[model samples]
Target: MDNYRFILSGGGTGGHIYPAIAIANELKERFPDAEILFVGAKDRMEMEKVPQAGYKIEGLWISGVQRKLTPKNLMFPLKVISSLVRSASILNKFKPHAVIGTGGFASGPLLKVASVKGIPCLIQEQNSYAGITNKLLADKVKKICVAYEGMDKFFPKDKIVKTGNPVRSDLISLSENRDNAMQFFNLDMDKPTLLVLGGSLGARRINELIEDKLSFFKTFGLQLIWQCGKLYYEEYKKYDSEEVKVYPFINRMDFAYTATDMIISRSGAGAVSELSIVGKPVIFIPSPNVAEDHQTKNAKALVAENAAVMIAERDLDTEFEEDFTDLMLTKNRQQELSDNIKRMSLPDATKRIVDEIEKMLGKG
Candidate 1:
């Protein structure tokens, strides 16, 4: 183990990409001299993001199979075989000590090749409802790190480690910055602040819903910090004013979390995990566009625990105002959601996943 080398694979979306980057970061911190390489789908976000995170990455020609039969489905087999061949080539050359996957088309082939090569591998499953890639590789990997309970339904119980998803470390510690946060956002602390996140690219339904309720929000006496996302900033920038501060993206997310009293967001696994750490009463608007309606399922997990509220994208027109009104006025309900979500947070998840990796290498 003198020259520890590791390969991480995942992509397609931020959900799959960030966790791999987070784990790679932690491994770099612990083993400063170790070589960490990333493998991601060629055209996906990870090729850019991984490099931004200061790691070299190799791309595989890969994409997920479409749900409905279409022309793209014909390319599926060729893509998989090509990806498998490419992944095998990379594995042979890198000769990685361990390969880690965070669930995407690229990871499927990369981890499968590594496993066949007798390399120990691990996967971090972000959602309560496991993704197809992770499920397929469950038995092949040495360990399965998950963000939710009962993932035994997907992976072997003996192999599953209940480590929550890794989030930006800066987000985990900001409790002492409230006063500075308020000033930074130029927000008045007298009004109850609502933070709205539509994710980095922005959710179309959430943006439209916010547009429909702008006047009503002011009537409800709430100030807002809205992240309309980079994709829809121009469409929603008109809403920005004294009471509603709108941005394409909030780079200073820790400050945004600190300044706000409550959150209205899309309940992707990453958002759910970060919100749990922020310990705010959150109203989730899960995107219906995702595969298997997983966002709604992710939100339902917290709703079951009384840790969050949810309004389906289709139900937003009918349920948004009423549910938000009741939650906003009910002080005790707010506290209950906040406290319970905090209990669900796993701030040490990155460290825990790295611990499991070390154990696999007989270094634990």
Candidate 2:
């Protein structure tokens, strides 16, 4: 393992980006002198976020195909060709022992190059249903680290390893931070707190739902800590008051988890993974706009385990109040959901993923 070098690529969203960073961070802890390089799409968040994590990253000239036919779709082949050439050039220069793809536009090219070069390559899929990029690269990669079971439907069963998503290291042990969390959000410790996450950019429906229900939430004597997301901050900021804390995005997510008695969230892979660790009684409102509507599938996996409750996007308008009221009134239901979700958590996800990487490289 001396002087081990690795290439990891993923981005476009925090769900993909943070896992790649967590894997890179874990690698550094194991081999302090190890050289880790990140490859990400040019102009994507990873270009900025990866560098902020203290890792060197190169940007690929790449983007995903639009679901609808567009003039931009005409440029897809050229971007793919340009990215593949650049990825090969990168692998040739870095000469890494292995490569990891956490599923993003850039990872497709980067891992394709690494797999063709006969280098050990692994991919981490964060959802219950596989993403388009990972599905295309499935056979080429050596191992697939996953957070959900029954991924055999998407990936080769022999290559699959059910390792959960790596949560932010700072988010662990939130129970111990309860007092600090209360002060952090400046919320009343006596009232039950409801934390709503709409993701970094925001979800239109979730924001609209909250906009319409702020009074309903207030009537229940429920204190709210709402991450309205950057896009909707201006529209929703007026709702912020002594009982409701509003922010464009949350910096202290650990505190948010600790302070909340209930969670209303969009069920992305990262959110589900983190909440499974937080062990809160969450009511998942899965976004319907994603590829394969996988957020709903991600939530369903937990619902089957009795780890959380779920409502489809179409059902939210008609069903949210009744569902929410039932959850709030049932004290044992909260503890039951919390305990079950915690049981499904994999605290050692990063460690387990890296263990597979080591095994792949024959350094296990």
Candidate 3:
């Protein structure tokens, strides 16, 4: 067990990809001699990102089936067959001690193949709702690590472990980075600041809402750190000035979290986990377009706990101003939210997940 081999598979979005990378990082740290390989769908972000994180990865010729009938949908069976063949070949060559899946289309084929080969397998489900791929792999997986409660509906109760999502290590501590954050964003520390996040690619509705509410935010003397995403950065960068800073992406999220007093964000599982660790008062506007409206479900879980505020995308136009105003004006409510959300954070999630992997490999 001194020189173990593990395969980490998942990726379509950062929500799936980062957790896999986080787990890989921990395994590397604890087992320096371990061989880690990532498997993801070809042409997806993981193909690029996993390598950037310093891991070798193999790409499967697979993608998710679309809802409507299309050429891509028609080719789904062929893609699955191809992916299975590739996955089987990979497992045969790599012969990993355990295979870890974080849930995306690529993981479906790989984990399915791994489990069938009788290799030890574990999957991390990052959402309140289990994804189609993870659901399909549930019966076969040795253990299911989940971020939310009540996931037994999708997974077997006997196999479930409520280990929170793996968040990036840099986000765990933000207090000491405040001065650097303030200087980095070039915002006055005396003024209250709001951080707006619209997920990785950016949300059009969120960008529009910010544009419409800029004058209102100015009235409250609120400064802004807006991450409009690369797709919309050009369109929104004109608003950047003394009071507002615009970024296509914030490379240093630790700084961004440390500097902000409050956040307005999409409630993707990754964002929810990171914000909880950041411990800032947040107004979650969950994306309506995702599968199963899971973003809303994820936000509602926190809202039910009084840990965060959630405003559906459909309700944003009608309720955002009042909700935003109420939270901003109530100092005690803000403190309550910050405290509650912080309580929801699982700072050791990455370690906990790796612990599961170790147990699967009999190295626990």
Candidate 4:
């Protein structure tokens, strides 16, 4: 793998950014001498996060085409044109061995340019349902790495590899940190813990449900570790009490997972992958806002195997509290969910993806 440089693109949310970072981290470990550069949409989280992760990143003036006719939609064509030109310049200057996309609008132009240049291109789709960007680039990508099975419905069957999402290494062997984690969160270890996560920016529906039912947590004698996301934190901060530990974000998620007896979460691809590996009993509230309702599809995949329980966002008002209360009280159900979810985990996904890349590079 001589003359190897890497260009990684994808970022609009942590789901995209974290997976790209995970792959970049894996590549760095395998190819320490390889120059890695990140390309992401300007003014997005990746611009800040990529640098924070100790990598060089360049931003392209790109934004998604709005589904509704809006002022932003008018600028879509110009932005796409500018982004493609800029991506070509970056690719030309860096001469990367491979261009990897992790599924976001910014990746569309960048990966399209790399494919045109005949650079080996790979994409990691972190959803059960394919995003428009990944689907559009599917024919051009040399290989497609995915977390869900039956993705041949979206991409070419021969090009697809069912590599589960790469979780943070710290999470893989997370063991025996229950007390430390509870102390860190200032939670009570004597009480059964319920950890609720609704993605990095937070889920408004989930937040609202928690807000309305904050007192219901006491019913099960449960300690709460609730990440209310930045948007809802201010409103939810008032609910923080001795039994409830509330935060805008949890930096050490592995600790939170280790400390908890159960999890309440949105079944995003990354969250599902991590939860499966962590093997915690989960109550999934699939976000309806995502493309193709992929979050619901993801949740169903596990629910079908009796690995998780799904509560629709719309049903949360009437159903969530009751379902959650019953779930928390049922120890047998929790153990069953934990065991079944763990059975579906693919912890070696990072290694498998790297192996595929190396095989494509003919140096494995």
- The C-alpha TM-scores of every prediction are 0.98, 0.97, 0.98, 0.96
List the candidate numbers ranked by TM-score, top first.
3, 1, 2, 4
Q: Model 1: clashing residue pairs?
A: none
What residue runs in model 3 are displaced by over 4 Å at the alpha carbon?
A: none
Q: Residue-wise lDDT of candidate 1 within 1-364, one digit each (tens)?
A: 4369999999899999998999998998899889999999998899999999999999999899988999899999999999999999998898899999998889999999899889999999999899999999998989999999988989999999999999999987876577888888888878889999999999888889888898888887889999999999999999888899999999999899988889999988899999999999999999989887899999999999999999987788888899999998899999999999999999999999999999999998
lDDT of 4 by residue, 1-364 (tens): 4447989999998889998898888998888888999999999999999999999999999888788999999998999999999999999999988889998989999999999989989999999889999999999989999988889999999999999998889888887577898888888778888898988789998888777776777777888899999888898898888998889999998789889988999998899999999998999999999878999999999999999999998887788877887787788998999999999998998888888888777786
- Colliding pairs, model 3: none
List candidate 4 stretches off by more than 4 Å. Answer: 1-3
The per-prediction tally of clashing pairs is 0, 0, 0, 0
Off by over 4 Å in 1: none
lDDT of 3 by residue, 269-336 (tens): 99999998889999999888998899999999999999999988789889999999999999999999
lDDT of 2 by residue, 1-364 (tens): 4599999999998899999999999999988989999999999999999999999999999999998999889999999999999999999999999999999899999999899999999999999999999999999999999999899999899999988999999866665567898998888888999999989988888888888898888778999999999998998898889999989999988888888999999999999999999998999999988889989999999999999999998998899999999999999999999999999999899999999998997877
What local lDDT score does residue 186 receive in model 2, on the 0 to 100 scale? 88
**lDDT for each of the candidates?**
0.92, 0.93, 0.93, 0.90
Better of 2 and 4 by lDDT: 2
TM-score of 1: 0.98
Please give the RMSD to the true structure for each candidate, in Å. Answer: 1.0, 1.2, 0.9, 1.4
